[model samples]
Structure formats: structure tokens, C-alpha cells
Target: MLLNQLIKELITKMGDDELIIGHRNSEWTGLGPIMEEDIAFSSMAQDKIGHSWALYRILHEELGGEDPDQFAFMRSEKEFKCCHLTEMPIGSYDFSLMRHFLFDHAETVRYNSMLQSSFLPLQQLARKVRGELKYHTLHADAWIIQLCRAGEESYLKMQTALDNCFQLACGIFEAGPDDKLLADEKVYPGEEALYGQWIENIYPVLVKASLNVPERKEPVYGGRYGKHTAYLQPLLNEMGEVFRLNPEATW
Candidate 1:
């Protein structure tokens, strides 16, 4: 693929991930274990979707992609690049919390790496995104530590959540075919490097929480190439339902 095309793909993938996960976060709107958590997840959901809109605008305005609304809502399931971790149903509170911790840290590492991207648009956006992600990660880390330290039951639940989510979390870094070319051009550091940084970034937090980081597990891949779980199609359906009803309607 041409460098421009690869850049579009990269941005599209990131936007799709954010949009889907943001919707998932919104699912907790009134359903959080606590009122504070309800608001927190809802706020994070808005931030994530706003980030996606910014990314999609980069694609449309800078890269000749379609309108952000049509591109996001009208695409088929197989066309989306969101990882399975984002597609999975928000399970129990433990699972949702763990997923939030893992996913947000991975996002933080990626945005930080993009702080110097050769792509000027992404680099500029990264400056703004890094600030927002700081609080996202802080919230995630604080909750993780507090929950784990609460008691033996809470500790074990968090540990189990970590073990269950680690592999899926690793899927967030599924390598792209153009990763090397992008890396060589300094568009952004490739997935392998980002993956390493993610592990290093999250390791201390997990250790502090007394949670065991699952070792040597294979990352669940295929999301980047459009292979998704059964969960995704339904999510896409529900997400785009309103838009599908009236694509030409102004929001």
C-alpha cells in the first residue's frame, strides 16, 4: 500500500476501536456499581467517541475518506478494525474494570508514542489526546489498586479479571501489514515496539495492585484484518441503528 493509504488504514483502525469501545463504555451509563463510576464511564465514553470523531475527521479532511458519520455507521462488520477485546460484552464489574485498565493503558502508550509522528495531523492530535488519556489511566489505575487492596475477595476477583483479560488485552497490539513501513517513515512506532512499551507501562501498576500479569500468552489476533467475533456484528448493528434509520438526517 502507498504510504498515504497505510496512514489512512492506521487512522481508520484507531478510530474504529475508539468508537466501538466508547459505545461499550456508554453501556455502563446508569448501570455502574456506584454512582461515581456511572458518571466516570459515561464521561470516558464521550471522550473516546470524541477522539474517534477527531481521528475520522483527519481521515476525511486530510486523506480523502468519506464523511465520518457514513464511514463509521454505514460500514459492514467485516470492514471494522476494532479488536475483539473492544467487541466483547461488558461482562461483570470485575471484567469491565480490568478491561478498562488494560485498554486505557494501551491507548495511553500509543498516543504517547504518536507525540512525534511524522504525520503532522496525528502528532498534533496526540498532544491533545495525551492530556485526556492521563486522567483516564489515572482513574483506571486508582480503581484497580483500591479494589485489589480492599480485601481477599476483591483481590482475588481482580486477579482473575487480569488473567482473563491479559491475552485479549494483548490483542490490542495486533500487528499491521504496513507497520514496518510506517515505523521506518516515523509515522508512528510500530505495534511490536508499542506492545513492549505497554507491558512495561502496565507492569508496575499490576504489581502494585498485587495482580499477576499473565506471562507468555499468545495474543488473540485477526481484528486488524477484519476478522471479528460474533459479538461485533450485533454491536455494529446496535451502534448504527439510529444513523441507519436516517443517514441523511443531521444530528
Candidate 2:
């Protein structure tokens, strides 16, 4: 694949991941265990969605892609490249917290690596996203540590959530056919390398929190190639319910 093609694929996948996870986080709007948590998760949801919009804008302006809103909300299920990890519903507070911890760390590392991208647009955007992610990881780390240390009950829940999410979290690093082009061209580090850094970054926090990182296993794949779980299509339909009614209608 050409370099621009590779960049577009990588960026679109990142954008999709951010957008889906934002939606998942938003599901906690009024249902959080506490009011403060409800507000916090809602804030993070906006951040993630905004991050996705910024990335999609880069795709549109720098990579000759479609308009950001149409490309994001109007795409079919098979056109989305988000990982299965992001598609899973926010089952419980524990699951959502654990997912946030795992996924945000991966996102942090990925954007940090992108700071050095040969592609200037991505490099600039990554720097901005990386700043926002700093607060995200901070929120995640504080909660993970607090909950893990609250008591045996909280600790056990966190451990179980970690166990449940580990494999799916690994899917964030699913390798793609064009990854080498990005790696070789310095547009971004390949997923494997970013995965390693993510592990390293999160391991210390888990250790400090007295939690066990789940044992290594096969990473879920196929999302990058348009494969997704049953939940995604429904999500798209709901997300686009208003948009599809009149694509050009001004709010």
C-alpha cells in the first residue's frame, strides 16, 4: 500500500476506536455509581469523541478522505475499524473502569509514538491527543489504585475485571498488513511495539495497586479489517438515527 493509504488506514482505525469507546463511556451518563463518577465519565466521553473528530479531520484534510462527520457516523458496520474491546458494553462499573485503564494506556502509548511520525499532520494531532490522554490515564490510574486498595471485595472485583478484559484489551494491538509501511516510514511504531510499551506502562500501576495483570494470550484481531461484533451495527444504527434522517439538515 502507498504511504498515504497506510496512514489513512491507521488513522481511521484509531478514530473509530476513540469514537466507539466514547459512546460506551457516555452510556454511564446518569448511571454511575456516584454523581462525581457520572460527571467524570461523561467528561471523558466528550474528550474521546473530540479526539476522534480531530483524527478524522486530519484524515479528511491531509489524506484526501471524506468529510469527517459523514465518514464517522455514516459508515457501515463493516467499514468501522474499531477493536472489539471498544465495542463491548459497559457491563458494570468494574468492567468499565478496567476497560478504561487498559484502553487509555494503549491509546496514550500509541499517540506518544505518533509524536515522531514522519507525517506532519499526524505528528501535530498526536501531540494534542497525547496531552488530553495524560488526564485520561491519570483518572484511570487514580481509580484503579483507589478501588484496588479499598478492600478485598473491591480488589477481587478489579482482579476479575482485569482477567475478563485482558484478552480483549490485547486486541488494541492487532497487527495490520500495512503496518510495516508506517513502521518503516516512521509514521508510527507498529502495533506490536506499541503493545509492548503499553504493557510496560500499565504493569507498574497494576503492581502498585496490588492487582494481577492477566496472563498473556492471543490478541483478538479482525476489527482493523472491518470485522466487528454484533453490537457494532446496532451502535451505528443508533448513532446515525438522526444523521441518516437528513444528512444535510442543519441542527
Candidate 3:
């Protein structure tokens, strides 16, 4: 495929993934592990949802009147472009924290790469997104510490979540031809590089928490190429329920 087509595909897929993940995560509002984290996670979820909204708008207004919600909510499971990471069940607090750590780490890297995008809109959006995640990561790190220090059980659970989920987490970086184009064009760094950097930064945090970092494995594939986990359908079902019931109803 041509580079431009690939770029467009990459953006669209990434957008849909964020839209659903953000929406799902946001559902945890007021239901999180603690009050502060509840608020913080919801805030982060809003950031993602806001970013998704922008991506959807860009897809519709800038690209064409594409059915952003349909692509997001009503698409077939295979049609979904989200990675296995975001679609996984939100586990216990420790598990969620582990997921948060993995996710925020990759997103930080993705935003950094996107910061250099040649496309002005993409570059600007990425820069803005990067700026927002700082607090989230900080909160996650703090929680990791508190949880790890709180008890052996918390630490062990966090370790398991980290081990079980990190592979899928890494899949978030499975780049495509568009990734190549962006890297070659100096618009973005390769995902492998980003993933490596995350390991470097996050490894010590896990070590300090006495949380066992899972032996990194070959990524479990299927983010950039649009293959989602089995869990995505149910989430989308709930997400689209309201809209499906009344496609024409105003919010």
C-alpha cells in the first residue's frame, strides 16, 4: 500500500482503539480502588476519550463523513484495530495498576514518536497528549509503591498482572508499513525503540517495588494490524448499546 494510505489506516485504527479503551476505562469512575485513584483514572480516561473524540472528528471532518462511532462501537471483532492489551478485563487494583503502568508507558513513547510527525495536526495532537499523561504516570508510580509496600499480596498480584499482561502490552507497539514510512521519513521513531525505552525506564520501578517483572516475551501481536482480543466484542456491545438503541437520539 502507498505510504499515505498506510498513514491514514494507522491513524484510523489507533483512533478506534483509543475510543473504545477510553470509554471502557471511564466506566470505572467512582468505582476505582480508592477515591484519589478513582478520580485520577477517570481523569486519564477522559483524556483518552477526549483524544479519541478529536481523532474521530478528524476522521469525520478532515477525512470525510465517516461513521466514527460505527467503526468504534459496531465493527466486527476482527475489524477492531485495538491491541490485546486494552481489551483485556480490568482486573483487581494491582492488576489495573499493572495495566496502567504498561499502557501509560507505551502511550508516553507513542506520543513522543508522534511529537515528531511531519503531519502538523498529528504532531500537534501528540505533543498535547504527551503533556497530559505526566500526572497519570506519577500517580501510577505512587500507587505501585504504596501497594507494594502495603503487603506481599499486593506486590505478588501486581507482579502477576505485570507478567500476564506485559506481552499484550508490548503488542501495542507492533508497527506496520505506515510505521516504517513514518520512521524513514523521520516523522516517528520505530515502535521497537519505544518499547525498549519503556523497559529501561519501567524496569527499575518494578524492581524497587520488589514486583517481579515478567520475562519479556515476543509480543502477542495484533494492534496495528486490527486483530483485537475476544474480550473486545462484549465491551463494544455495552458501548454501542445506547447508540444502537437510538441511533438518531440526541444525547
Candidate 4:
């Protein structure tokens, strides 16, 4: 692919992940196990959505893409590049927490790698996103460790959650066709490198939490190329309903 096309694909994938996961996070608004968790997830959802908007803005202003709102809210499910992990329903609190732990750490690794991107706009966004993701990973890490150490039952549940989420989480690193091009141009590190870094970054935390990382798991892929679970279309419908009802109406 052309460099410009490659960069657009890369950022669009990043932005789609943020947007979809932001909506998934928002689903916990009133459903968290505790008041504090409710607030924390809600706040994180806002941050994720804001990050998506910023990415879309870069696409619009720098790469000649569509409006942020249109890009986020009007796209069909197949048009989105978010991973299937983001598309899955937020299951039990254990599942949600584990997913958060895995996903946010992956986000941390990706953004950190982008800190020196040849794409100046992405590099600037990475600098700003890095600080916010610190607290996100911190929150996830603390909870994982705390829950795992709480009791045998809690520990078992956490371990199970980790096992269940591991493959899906691996999908988060699914490579774009142009990933090598991006890496060669120093636009960003390729997915393979980011996957390696993500493993290193999360292994210590998993050990500290007493959770075992599942071995030899096959990654679920295809989301980067628009294939998704059945869950995603319903989510897209609900998320876009209001915007579609009045696309011309001012917020």
C-alpha cells in the first residue's frame, strides 16, 4: 500500500479500537460491582472516547478523512477495524476486569512505541495518551493483584478470566497488511514487535497477580480487516441510533 494509505489504515484501526471499547466500557456506567468501579469505568470510557475523537480529528485534518462523529457513529460494523475482543460483551466482573487489564496494557505498549513516530501528529497524540493510560494500567494492575490475592476462589476466578481472555487479547495485536511498511517508515513499530513488548510488559504483572498466562493459545484475528463477532452489529446499532436519528441536529 502507499505510505499515506498505510498510515490511514493504521490510525483508523487504532481509532476504531478506542471507539468500540469506549462504548463497551460505557456499558458499565451503572453496572459495576461497586460505586467506585462504576465511576472509574465511566471515567475511563470518557477518556477512550476522547482519544478516539482526537484520532479521528487527525485523520480529518491531516489525512483528509471523514468527520469524527460520522466516522465513529455512522460506520457499518464491517467498516470498523476494532478487534473482536472489543466487540465481545462485557461478561462477569472478573471477565471485564481481566479484559481491561490485558487490553489497557496492550494500549500502553502501542502508544509508547508510537512516541517517536515519523507521523508527527500520531507522535503528539501518543505523548498525550501515554499519561492517561498510566492510570488505566495502574487501576487494572492493582485490581488484578488484589483480587487474585483475596482468596482461593477469587484467585481461581481471576486465573480463569485470564485464561478465557488471553486468546482474545492476543487478537489485539493482529497485524495490518501494511504493518511492515509502517515499521520500515518509522511510522510505528510493527505488530509483532508490539506483541513481544506487550508480553514482556504484562508477564511480570501476571506473575505478581498470581495469574497464569495461557500457553500456546491461537489468536483470533480478522477484525482488522472488518470481520467481527455477531455482538458488534447490535452494538453499532445502539451506539448510532441517536446520531442516525438526527445527523444534522446539533449536539
Count the clashes in each prediction: 0, 0, 0, 0
Model 3 whole-model lDDT (C-alpha atoms) = 0.74
What's the lDDT for all of these models?
0.92, 0.91, 0.74, 0.92
Lowest summed lDDT window (length 10), candidate 3: 62-71
lDDT of model 1 at residue 156? 96
Query: Which portions of model 2 show Cα errors greater than 4 Å?
Result: none
- lDDT tens digits, residue span 1-251, model 1: 59999999889889988999999989999999999999999999999999999999999999999999999999998899988899989999999899999999999989999989999999999999888899999999999999999999999999999988889989999988779999999998999999999999999999999887898478889898899999999988898999998899985
Report the lDDT tens digits of candidate 4 across residue range 124-225.
999998989999999999999999999999999999999889999999999876788889999988999999999999999999986778874699899999
**1-251 in candidate 3: lDDT tens per residue?**
36556566767766766776687678778798678778888888888878777776666665563666655656666766777888877766666777887788777767777876876677888877776878777877888877888877776777777778888887877777556676787656777778888888788788788877776668888755666667788887888888888676665
Top candidate (lDDT): 1
- Write candidate 2's Cα lDDT for 1-251 as tens digits: 48888888889999999999999999999999999999999999999999999999988888888989899888889889999999998998999999999999999999899888898988888877777799999999999999999999999999999999999999999998778878889988899899899999999999999887777677778898899998988888888898999998876
TM-score, model 1 to reference: 0.98
Native-to-model Cα distance after best TM-score fit, residue 38 in candidate 2, in Å: 0.9
TM-score-wise, the better of 1 and 3 is 1
Give the CA lDDT, 0 to 100, for residue 212 in model 3: 70
lDDT of 2 at 97: 98
**Cα RMSD, model 4:** 1.0
Clashing pairs in 1: none
